[model samples]
Target: MQERNVDIAIIGAGSAGLGAWHAARQHTQSLVLIESGAFGTTCARVGCMPSKLLIAAADVAQQARDAEGFGVKVSGVTVNGPAVMERVKRERDRFVGSVISSMSRIEDEDRILGAAHFEDANTLVVGDHTRIHAKRIVIATGSRPTWPDFLNGAGDRLIINDDIFDWDDLPESVVVFGPGVIGLELGQALHHLGVRVRMFGVGGGIGPLGDPDLRKLADQEFNADFPLDPDANVLRVELEGEQVAVTFHCRDSDTEKTERFDYLLAATGRRPNVDRLELKRTGLALDERSIPRFDRLTMQCRFDDGSLAPIFIAGDANQDLPLLHEASDEGRIAGDNAGRYPDIRAGRRRTPLAVVFSDPQIASAGVSYAELKRRDESLASIAVGEVSFEDQGRASVMRQNRGKLRLYAEHGSGILLGAEMFGPRAEHLGHLLAWAIDQRLTVERLLEMPFYHPVVEEGLRTALRDLNVNLRRGPAITERCLECGPGA
Candidate 1:
């Protein structure tokens, strides 16, 4: 058997793993990275890049159809599904290739092209013959889409995000299960591209907006494109001829409605890839969720004696924060801490930012109003400022005013705590709010910043102005950084 030794070993060559590698390589050369699949990360190959490509294509088609609203009647619009898919794959392949090319710059010996299983806290066995003794191990194996037991008989009818982008043509009709991020994004995109799509979610809202008000607004805009059943509780599957039959039952209704579709997309959610690594061999305790316990701040696992073990978990595999940016940050923390083991240090986490890239784009930063209200009983001390695109000048000019923006802050402190919105270019607005919250900026401070005229950002200013009205400590807004004397 072949044996080797490394100071730090990273499992899974996805975004989190790559981030860990990049960070740890700076401190030590005694590092090895292991992968059993394609070199490119999930975001590049399946999750983010390819999905955005398809969404961009669908956006074009949607714009063409909506051109009549602007008093410009354009006709002869035809969507070639195969051609669109071709371009998506061609472009997606280029992205995947770039990721692989960068990784290839590492020496071949440092990259082990196989799955790794833990033999002990400091030992890993790769395949049958190659054994690696790592002083510290960083688990960044990421996650995979999960299928429910109902899909057991779904032979050729099931599709997940991993394979959706590879299709050469669009399905005639599809029933999307779980109206989370993947389901809503793909469902809306497919509907825009002339596919008949029906989306089902367990709750009354789509995506992870976390606020009831924002979810209602998002559902309204999303339903305009396709049939959305956000309250579907039970889904039963059966076969109907060559097609798959699905019965959706809403929580309030006793009736069962069955529909047959050419495709069934299971976007329920994703689970950490922890089981495959044989974590039991590591001698770490597993929680009820079958996940190894690790410190959220330092990303370090503890031994039975409460001492830090030479192990770390990061990215989706940790099941804490699954977003790409969060994974990258966690990976860096894990790698940095792993290399400097026995002297573990916690790094500051980034401000919470999540986005759903559907039309109007649902995004949020920091804590949501719902979360604050759930934990805090003093609702009067919390203030919410809202601005609707229905009346915004820029939105009206472009005929794209079908959403709302909400900003949440403390009533007395005027500290921007969180923001939730469904508005045009909300992704950009969300980032601004995230940075402001991260900096602990006050409402008065944000108002002092410049806001241009006739832009979506003006809507943010409007919301901030409304929020400032409820601040108890000071005036709603002051124009200057410091309360200035009259030209003295």
Candidate 2:
């Protein structure tokens, strides 16, 4: 094996690793980016980008069907699955090409195509080819979908989200497991595209919703489209001919039912790709999942002595926040700190923001609703403001009004702590709220912002005003705010 020395070594050539490579290069020119798989980032390949492509097509089909609500008659709305897959694959390749193109800017010597494992604290070995003694290492190996062994019996009848984009055409029906972000998005998209989709989960949680009210509202709306039992008691899965058969106790029903489908999609969850890295050789302090315990601000893993180790883990490999943007931010932080070494300074950590692309999109920013419930302080310390989009003017006009929003604030400080929403345009709303939280703005300050008439944002203003009233900093909410639509 050829041996080499480098200032920094970044494992995985995905989004986070790429970010780390860029940031680390600013301090040292000697670095290597190693990968065991394709170069494109997850978002560009099997994740957000391709998923959105499918969602966009589904949305168009849904819009056509919903046109009758606006006195527009739409007779036939057929989804051409082959053509849909073609565009998805074509656009997906374009995205992957762009990422590979950016990677081409790096010197060929800095790139290695093989799996890397730690030989010791300061050494890494890649298969039987290269040995690297890296002064500092960044583990951005990312993550992979995880499911129970029982599901493996499905053989070719089982699939993950990654396999969906490669399908030559849509299947007639699919039985999906896990109602998390991945399951919810793909299941709904397939449902709207006229595919038979039945989703079941062990937990009652719907998407990213921690607020029970929003989850319940989401449950009702999603169930109207297809069978979605967020919490179901599943017995077993077995292979029946070419199809997958599932046995489960239906939600709210004591009777057991067996269902067969073309495929059993496991959108269950993801596990960090750290098990095979031989981290024990580094003698680092690992968490329950074998991930190194690291400081969020410093992004530095700790040794057994609780001192900063040379190893840093970021992105999905850390498994803290799995969003693409968060991974990029963490990668930069880890890379910069690794490069700086002994002169390490804390990096800027952005306010938390997560958005689920399901219908009436789900989003959460800053503190989560579940976090507040764990607080021992008085309930009076936290003030909540809520708005229902069911009657919101713009939402009704768009025929897309079917969700709710909640804002949490400090009672005495009047500062907005966080927010959770299951409403129209939540992607945009989540961003505005995240900015407010980052700026440490108060509810009163938010209410002062302009809300144009007949916009979905008027709903945000209504919630902020409600928050102001709860905080007792402003006059009580009027029965009808003439300036904005009446809760409508």
Highest lDDT among the candidates is held by which one? 2
Residue 280 displacement in candidate 2 (angstroms): 0.5
- For candidate 1, what is the TM-score? 0.94
The parts of candidate 2 lying over 4 Å away from their true place are: 472-480, 483-488
- Give the alpha-carbon lDDT of every model: 0.85, 0.90
Worst lDDT window (10 residues) for model 2? 479-488
Model 1 lDDT, residue 170, Cα: 86
| TM-score per candidate | 0.94, 0.98
Local accuracy of candidate 2 as per-residue lDDT tens digits, 325-436: 9899989998998788878888888899999888889999999888887783445678999999988889988987889999999987889999999989999999999999
Question: Where does candidate 2 clash, by residue pair?
Answer: 391-488, 392-488, 393-488
> For model 1, how does the per-residue alpha-carbon lDDT over 267-293 read when each residue is reduced to its tens digit?
999999988898888788788877889
Alpha-carbon error at 26 in model 2, in Å? Answer: 0.5
